[model samples]
Target: MPNHIDFVATLAPGIFSYELATGGQVILAMDVGTLVKKGSDVLVSTRNAVKAPDLGKLKQVVVQQYDVLDEREKMVRSASAKLEASLIRRFVELK
Candidate 1:
């Protein structure tokens, strides 16, 4: 049985569009420059080797983790990190 992939929850789902693949999808996790130029896919992930099943069920658990971490990390007074996060969010929104 393939592991279900809850990309939204684990990565902190935003108001963006997504394309699911039956019960089998893969979300590649990586770090890359955000909004490098313009109109870029920042968090681009290729289908993983593992096929996801029951994305809905997995989302509940993964989203919980995302929410907890995101909430606490939201408070950052760092000028540089703040700026970077801003750009990254924008990129994610567009992508």
Candidate 2:
């Protein structure tokens, strides 16, 4: 599992735009720079792989990958909000 603490949650999602090899634009996540420059269809791996998946092996399109990223983003937002509220409550008690 990823250390959630490593990420800095933001008030707004970053603007993402990319085109797939199949010819369509949609976006986010993983090695974003490589994806943007190469514009290759991608494989979705819950874990890192030593070898990138073959083009024939890639199943999900760019939009589907973004959907997964979006769900995780929502979770992070909720966690950040809860953390902020708890900190505020503690600060109030301190005052």
TM-score against truth, every candidate = 0.24, 0.41
Cα lDDT, all candidates: 0.44, 0.46
User: What's the lDDT for candidate 2?
Assistant: 0.46
Q: Largest lDDT belongs to which candidate?
A: 2
Whole-model lDDT, candidate 1? 0.44
- In model 1, the Cα lDDT at residue 74 comes to 69
Cα lDDT tens digits, model 2, 7-86, are: 22222232334456699654432332221111222323223112223332233444466678799999999999999999
Give me the runs in candidate 2 sitting further than 4 Å from their true place.
Answer: 1-31, 34-60
Candidate 1 local lDDT, 6-49, one digit each (tens): 23223322222335556534442222212212223234332222
TM-score of 2: 0.41
